[model samples]
Each structure stands twice: as structure tokens, then as C-alpha cells.
Target chain A: MHALQQKIREEGIVLSEQVLKVDAFLNHQIDPQLMHAIGAEFARRFEGTGVTKIVTLEASGIAPAVMTGLIMGVPVIFARKHASLTLTEHLLVAEVYSFTKQHNSMVAISPRHLGADDHVLIIDDFLANGRAAQALISIIQQAGATLAGLGIVIEKSFQAGRAELDAQGYRVESLARVSSLASGRVTFLD
Target chain B: MHALQQKIREEGIVLSEQVLKVDAFLNHQIDPQLMHAIGAEFARRFEGTGVTKIVTLEASGIAPAVMTGLIMGVPVIFARKHASLTLTEHLLVAEVYSFTKQHNSMVAISPRHLGADDHVLIIDDFLANGRAAQALISIIQQAGATLAGLGIVIEKSFQAGRAELDAQGYRVESLARVSSLASGRVTFLD
Candidate 1:
């Protein structure tokens, strides 16, 4: 967590009050060494929850989720944003709204992959509005699976995402939580 | 590689005369254990290549690319399918024709992430028509970066993908090459 926090301080760029660009190491251009450390940290945090599967959304979350899955020795099921021709009809689908994209999209997983007996750990790169995490949680619930917890790399604590998830009775753990972006500086939550 | 071959034999579904679906482990529902092994195999194959970075397209390719990046201890840069508002204006863009989606989509990478001095290894899940791989290669070339090599998890030998890459003088390595998928039977290329 300290390493991630240090990386955030060194490489992270704040474009605006709401935008934190970590493309250099977090999302677009990933730092595998840092990701491996982050994955190990998640595995350590959720050491004994019987996490059978790791769930995440497509695009950005895939990198960290794959690393976490590799460390946890669990299969990672990424919910596809677009249903391709190869995807079957029987699937657990959930609609999510992206605050960044400003649109609604559906994330889906084949029903055959998930079952009632599985325990899932939801992982994502950032938890801004918590829409993506909620959508994944919805899919897990629909599959009759138990939610182990949510692991996030960077979280915007100023946003209502944490409170919303807490209100829903879900445990959320974040490596770095940004409390404020005042005067073009990032302040971490204590 | 034998483990992956066996996984394909057991869990892979032969969709048609030409299409083999490994969604149970590769695409839709990923087996992290197998992916880690596959990642290790890729790392072993590309070891000492001075691979500075692992580049891949969005969606399915992200997982294997990340795994390879983790094993090789390099950064992984994934081209974005859609340009969100968060993306920077300076980018290396390429047009990729998706046969499955029946459309041409533009993939972009921030110019800040890739440079002329970088050695890039392209990784992907499947190699069929090879349009996506070509698009990625073009992007890397446009950035003036060195193309380390192309690594693929599954390659359909019946398709023209390998031939096209070979024509372009690329050292393409596929973990499993399928000669045919006729009547729900998979035959590997020797």
C-alpha cells in the first residue's frame, strides 16, 4: 500500500478537480512490478475468504484483476462490455452506468462459468462512483454467489462511492484513498 | 504448454468447423492457474529478449498481456478501444477491422506511454485473421518503437493470419496452433 501511495505521489497527474491520470502505471500503461505488488497485497488482505473467482469489468480493471487472480490462484471472470458473436445466450447480465463515459452499458458473464456455490472477490482499478463495482456485485448476487469483498487500487474518498457501498453492507478496501484535490494537490485520507 | 493443450482438449468447446472456444479458461471465464502457467511459458520463450514493454489490444488480450508483463517484469500498455474524455489528445491510433463484430474500430494509445527507444512485445488471446495484431504492429511502428515479437495463446493454422505475419517478416510464436477443428475434434499443427 505504501508503494502504491508513493507511486501515486510520484507519477500520478491531476488534470482537473475530478480527474486523476495514472496512465503511466495504473491503468492505460501498467507497471507490472507495481501491479504484482498490488496483487500480493490484495491476496494478503483477503487471505482466507475462500475466494473461488475474481470478477471485474473489461478494459482497465483486467490488468490488476488478472494479477490478483494469478496471485490468489483463482479464475478471473471479466464481464464483457459488448456481447460478441462468440458469447452464448445464457448469461448473467447487469447494466452499469459509467460516470466517466457518461452512458449506460451492460456487463455480462456466461451462466455456465458462475454458479451458486462460488465465492467472488470484485477487483477494479478505481472506485469513483462505485457503479462498476455495484454492477459486478449485482451479477454475483444474481448468480447466488457470496461476495468476499471489493478490492480497489485507487479510491476517491471525496466521492460517495465508499459510503454507498458501506450502506449496502459491503466491505471495501482501497490501497490509496484520495480525500481532496485542493489547490492542484492530492491529499490522502487518514 | 502441455497443460494448456490438455485444458483445451478437456474444457474447450469446438464451436464449428473452424472456431474453437476456450472461454471456459481463456476468453470468457479465465482459469488463472492456467493463465499463470501460460504467462510463465511466454516469459520463458521470450526470456532475454530485452522486452521493455508488453503491448496488447483491449478486451480479451488484456489478461494474457498483463500476465506476460508480470512474469517478464515490464510495463504493459493496452490500446484503448474507445477514446474517453480522460485520454490525452496526443495518441498513436490505428484502424482495426473486427471480423466478429463486423466493423472497423479504432484503437489508440497515448504517445506518452510509447516511444522510439522502447522494445515492445505484442501479446493477444487469439490469432485468426490477424487484423488486430497488424493494427497493433502498425501503431508500434508509427511510434518508432522496436517490435520485439508477437506472442499468441491460440493460433488457427487454417487461417491466413500466420502467413500474413510471416509475409511481414514477424517472428510470431503461438503456444497452441490448431490445424483443424472438424466435427468437434481439434488437431494440433506439428
Candidate 2:
């Protein structure tokens, strides 16, 4: 967690008061050692939670989720942002709005991968408005699966995402929490 | 490699003569242990090749690429399939056509992540018509980076992907090669 926070401070670019770009290491270009550490940390945090599956959105979420799944010895399921030709029928779909992109995309998962017997842990790269997280939670609910917990690499604490999830009674753990990205600088939450 | 072949035989679904759906492990719902094995195999195959970085497309390619990067002690960069708001200016872009989806998408990467001194190893989930591989190769070329090799998790040998890359004089290593999927049966290329 310290390493991640340090990396964000070192390489994260603050585009605006609301945008932080971690293209140098976290998302576009990744540091595998840091990813492994984050995964280990998540696995440790949820060690006794009996997590049967790790769910995440595609693209950025795959690395951390896969690493967590590897350490936790569970399967990782990534919801597709776009509808695929192969991914049709028995699908659990949820519409998610991306504040950054300013649009809504339907995220879907095959129900065959998730079931009522599964305990699912959600992992992702960034948490901002919590729209994506809510969409994943919706899909998990549709499958009648139990929510183990949510693991996020970076959270924009200035936003209401964490508060909403907390209010909803979901346990969310984030490795690096950015309190502010004011004046082209990053401030971490204590 | 044997384990991968066995997994394909057991869980891989052949939708048609050309399409093999490996959603059970390699993509949508991933088996983390199998992915680790794949990364180890790729690392073993590309050992001591002076690979400074691992490159792949987003979504499916992230897991294996990150695992290989972890073992090989290098950075992993995934080209974004769609244009990102933060990813603007000084971009190396290539247009790639997806055979299964019947669409063309422009893939882009930041020039800050890749450089002339870097040696890149391209990794991907599947190799079919070779368009994606070609696009990645173009990006590497644009950056003046050296191509170490190409590592593919599954190669449809019946298609022109392998032949095209081979013709282009790129060294390609595929963990599992399928010779045919006729009559809904997967035949490995021995």
C-alpha cells in the first residue's frame, strides 16, 4: 500500500482537480511487482472471507484482479464493457456511466461463470463515482451470489463513491486513497 | 504446455470451424493457476531475450502479460482499444480489424511508455488473422523499439496468423496450436 501511494505521488499526473493519470505505472503501463504487492495485500485483508471468485471490469481491472485471484487461488471473472458476439444468452447485464468518458455502457457477465453458491470479491483499478462498482454489484446480485468484499487499487476519496458504498453497507478496501488532486498535486487520505 | 493443451481439450468450445471459445479459463472466467502456468511457460520460452518490456492489447492480454512481466522483472504496457480522455497527444496509433467482431478499432499507446532503447515482447490471448499482432508490431516500430518475440496463449494454426508472422520473419511462440476445429473438435498441431 505504501509502495502504491508512493508510486502515485512520484508518477501520477494530475490533469485537473478531478482527474489523476497513473499512466506511468498503474493502468496503461503497469509495474508487475507493485501489482503483486497490491494483490498480496488484498489477499491478506480478505484471507478468512472465503472468497470463491474475484470479479472486475475489463482492461485496467484484469491485472490486479488476476493477481489477487492467483494469490487467493480463485477464479477471476471480468465483465465485458462491450457486448461480444460470443457473450450472448444467460447474461447478467448492468448499465454503467463513466463520468470521465461521459457516457453509459452496458457491462455484462455470463451467468454460467457466477452462481448462487459463489462468494464474489470485486477488484478494480480506480474508484471515482462508484458507477462501475455498483454495476458489478448489480451483476453479482443477479447471479444470487454473496458479496465477499470490494478491493480497489486507487480511490478518489474526494468523490462520493466510498461514502455511497459505505452507506449501502458494503465493505470496500482501497490501497491508495487520494483526498485531493488540487493544484497539480496529490493528497492522500490518512 | 501440456496442461494448456489438456485444458483446451477439456474446456475449450469450438463454435465453428474457425472460432474456439476459451471463456472458461483464458478470458472471461479465468483460472488463475493456469494463467500463472502460462506466464511461467512464456517466461521459460523467452528467457534471456533482453526483453525490457512486455506489450499486449487490453482486456484478455493483461493477465498473461502481467504474469510474464512479474517473472521476467520488466514493465508491461497494454495498448488501449478505445481512445481515452487522459491519453491524448504524442500517441502511437494503429488501426486493427477484429475478425470475429467484424469491426475496425484504432488502438493507441503513449509514446512516453515506449522508447527506441526498449526491447519489447508482444503477448496476446489469441492469434487468428494476425491483424492485432500486425498493429502491435507497427506500434513497436513507430517507437523504434526492438521486437524480441511474440508470445501467444492460443494460436489457430488453420488461420493465416502464424504463417503471416512467420513470413514477416518474426519469431512467434504459441503455447497451444490448433490445427483444425472441424466437426466441433479441436485438433492440435503436432
Candidate 3:
């Protein structure tokens, strides 16, 4: 977590109070070693929680989620952001509004991937508005799966994402939680 | 590779005369153990090639690319299909036509990720028309990087993808190369 916070302080580009881009290492272009560490940390934090699977959204969330699943030796089911020819019709669907892309898109998971017996640990890159996390939780709920916990690489605690998820009684662990971001500077939560 | 072929044989759904969906294991609902085997296979195939980085496209390609990067001890960079606020303006861009999505979208990679000195190994889930590979190749070419090789999980050899890359004189490998798919059955090339 210190490594991630250090990287954020060094290479994280804070475009505005609302937007912080870690594209250099986190999302678009990834540092696999850092991802491995994050994954291991997630595994350590969520150890012995009966995590049957790790779930995430497409694109950015896939790397950390994949690494987590690899470390935990579990299958990773990343809900598709867009409907493809391969994805079937019988899916648990949820609408996600992306502040970054400035649009609402559907996130879907196959019913076959999750069920009442599965305990899913949701993993993702950034937790800002918590919209993506909420969407994945909804998909899990629709599948009648248990929410084991949520793991995030970076959380904007200044936003209400963590607060809302806390009120929802979900156990969430964010490796690096940013208390505030302003003027191209970031402050991490203790 | 045999394990992957076996999974395809058992779980892969042949949807039509041409479309074979392995979303059960390869793309959508991912099997981490299978991906580890795949990453090892790709490493073995491209060993001692001085692959500084592994390149892939967003969404589906991230899992395999991440695994390969983890095994090869290199960074992984995936091109973005849709531009988000995080992606910078200075990017290496190429147009990719998705047959599954039935549309054309622009793929862009950060200039910060790729450079003249880097040797990149491209990985993906499927290679049918080779449009995705070609697009990634163009992005790598734009960055003046060396192409270490290409690794794909599945390839429709009956299609022109492998042929075009072969004509281009690049080393390419698909773990499971399908000879044909018809009447809900698949034939693989030796």
C-alpha cells in the first residue's frame, strides 16, 4: 500500500479535484509487479473469507482482478461492459454510469458464473463514485451470490463511495485511500 | 497448450459455421489455472526474446497479457478502445474493426508506455481476421518499438488472420488453432 501511495504521489497526474489519472502505471499502461503486490495484499487482507470467486468490471479492473484471482487460485469473472456476440442473453445486468467516460453503460455477468453457493470478492482499480462497484454488487445480488468483500487499489475517500458502501454493511478494503486531491497534489487517508 | 485445447473441446461452444465462443474459460468467465498454463506456454515459446513488455487490447486481452507479463517479469500495456478522461491527448492511435462488436473503434496507447528501445510481445484471446493484431502492430510501429512476437489463445486458421501475419514475416503462435467450425463442431489443425 505504501508503494502504491508513493507511486501516486510521484507519477499520478491530478487533472482536477475530481480526476486523478494513474494511466502511467495503473490503468491503461500497467506495472505488473505492482499489480502482483496489490493482488498479494488483497489476498492477505481477505484471507480465509470463503472467497469462491473474484469478480470485476471490464478494462481497468481486469488486471488487478486477474492478478487477485491468480494469487487466490480462484476463477475471475469480469462482467462485460458491452454486449458482444459471444455473451448469451441470460445474464445478470446492471447499469453503470461512468464519470470518466461520461456515459452510462450496461455491465453484465453470465448466470452460470455466479450462484447462491458462490462467495464473490469484488476487485477493481479505482473507487471514486463507487458506481462501478455498486453495479458489480447488484450483478452479484441478482445472481444470488454472497458478497465476500470488496478490494480496491485506490479509493477516493473524499467522495462518498466508501461512505455509502460502509452504510451498506459491505466489508471493503482499499490499499491506498486518497483523502483529498487538489492542485495536482494528493493526500492519503491514515 | 494441450490443456487449453482440451478446455476448448469440452467447454467451447461452437455457435455457428464460423463463430466459436470460448467465453466460458478464455474470455468472459476466466479460468486462472488455465491462464497460468497459457502464460507459461507463451513464455516458453517466446523465451530469450528480450521481451521488455507485453502489449494487448482492452477488455478481453488484458487477462492473458497480464498473466504473460507476470510470468515474463515485464510490464503490460493494453490499448484503450474508448477514450476516457484519464487517457492523455498524445497517444499512438489506430483504427480497429471488431467483428464481434460489429463496429469500428479507435484504439490508442500512451506514448509513455512504448518507445524505440522497448521489445514488445503482443498477446490476445482470439485472432480471426487479424485486425486487432494488425492494429497493435501499427501502434508498436508508430512507437518505433521492436516486435518480439505474437501469442494468441485461439485462432481460426481457416480465416486469413494467420496468413496475413505470416506474409508479414512475423513470428505468431496461437495455442489452439482451429481448422474449421461447422454444425456445432470444431476441428483443430495439427
lDDT of 2 by residue, B1-190 (tens): 8999999999999888988999999879998889889999999999988999999999899999999999999999999998878888679999999988999999999999999999999999999999999999999999999999999999999899999999989999999999999999999997
The 10-residue segment with the lowest total lDDT in model 1 chain A: A181-190
Top-down TM-score ranking: 2, 3, 1
- Ranked candidates, highest lDDT first: 2, 3, 1
lDDT measured at residue A60 in model 2 versus the true structure, 0 to 100: 93
A1-190 per-residue lDDT for model 2 (tens digits): 8999899988999999999999998779999989999999999999999999999999899999999999999999999998777776679999999998889999999998999999999999999999999999999999999999899999999998999999999999999999999899999997
TM-score of each: 0.97, 0.99, 0.98
For every candidate in turn, the CA RMSD to the true structure comes to 1.2, 0.7, 1.1
* Candidate 3 lDDT for residue A11: 85
Q: Point out where model 3 deviates above 4 Å.
A: none
* Candidate 2 residue pairs that clash: none
Please report, in order, the local distance difference test score of every candidate based on alpha carbons. Answer: 0.88, 0.94, 0.90
- Model 3 alpha-carbon miss at residue B179, Å: 0.7
Candidate 1 wrong stretches, greater than 4 Å? none
lDDT of 3 by residue, A69-173 (tens): 888999999999888887867989999998888899999999987899999999999898999999999999998999999999999999989999999999999
Could you tell me the lDDT of residue B1 within candidate 1? 66
Q: For model 3, which pairs clash?
A: none
